[model samples]
Target: MFNCNWGFMTGFGPGGGMGGFGFLFNLFIFGLLIFLAYKLIQRLSRPDGTRDREDSLEILKRKYANGEITTEEFSRMREILRS
Candidate 1:
């Protein structure tokens, strides 16, 4: 014969004894945490906020310095960006 503490088990365990909302509430909280975690990870992975406006300007200057782009093209693009 198993000496089962049914009262305590039902009260704390997954016996749906602490009202039906307990398990559903815990599940909703868990899902919310997962959603927030996913959004945080996505936000951290992108370079949008991490990069500044000057980054592109610096890169364009480097390309001009390296002779990858002509001076006219560089000046035109730089003026366009500055405006």
Candidate 2:
């Protein structure tokens, strides 16, 4: 007869079903999936050129408000940005 008590044969083995590293492997895969999903959602939320233009305009406005740029310079840049 075959040896049924061999650890690999049945679920009653020393480390149980999946062995020691199984939990860690599953956890890693779960984390990877979550990270990919988050990145996909972030990418899908923004339109291509629109997000960049908006971000650039916001930065320009902040700089003007902070007095880092002259009013003439701000106006010029704002006009350029709007065009």
Candidate 3:
């Protein structure tokens, strides 16, 4: 015999009745999301970001060897990369 009071039935319709427990649960979930995001970012960013640079340099070196770049350009690019 549950009489539904349509007035404030959902406590705040469409929003659901999360109340105190709801708020705490949401906060916990939000905190977990933030922590996970931080961890993911930390893992993605590293001093070994040099790998990408080296890979690009390798491509450039190959292009030079294939006679795609001028000698002067190759020397300049090599010097720039070494630094």
Model 2 per-residue lDDT tens digits across residues 1-83: 87456433333346556765655665677799999999999999977788778889999999999999999999999898877
lDDT, candidate 3, 3-83, per-residue tens? 775532343334658666656666677799999999999878866658877987998899999999999998898888878
Say which candidate scores most in lDDT: 2
Question: Each model's TM-score?
Answer: 0.42, 0.53, 0.42
lDDT of the candidates, in the order given: 0.76, 0.78, 0.77
lDDT of 1 at 52: 58
Query: Tens digit of lDDT per residue, candidate 1, span 19-72?
Result: 666656666777999999999999889876346557878999999999999999
Clashing pairs in 3: none
Pick out the ten consecutive residues of candidate 3 with the lowest summed lDDT. 5-14
* Number of the predicted model whose TM-score against the real structure is largest: 2
RMSD of 2: 7.0
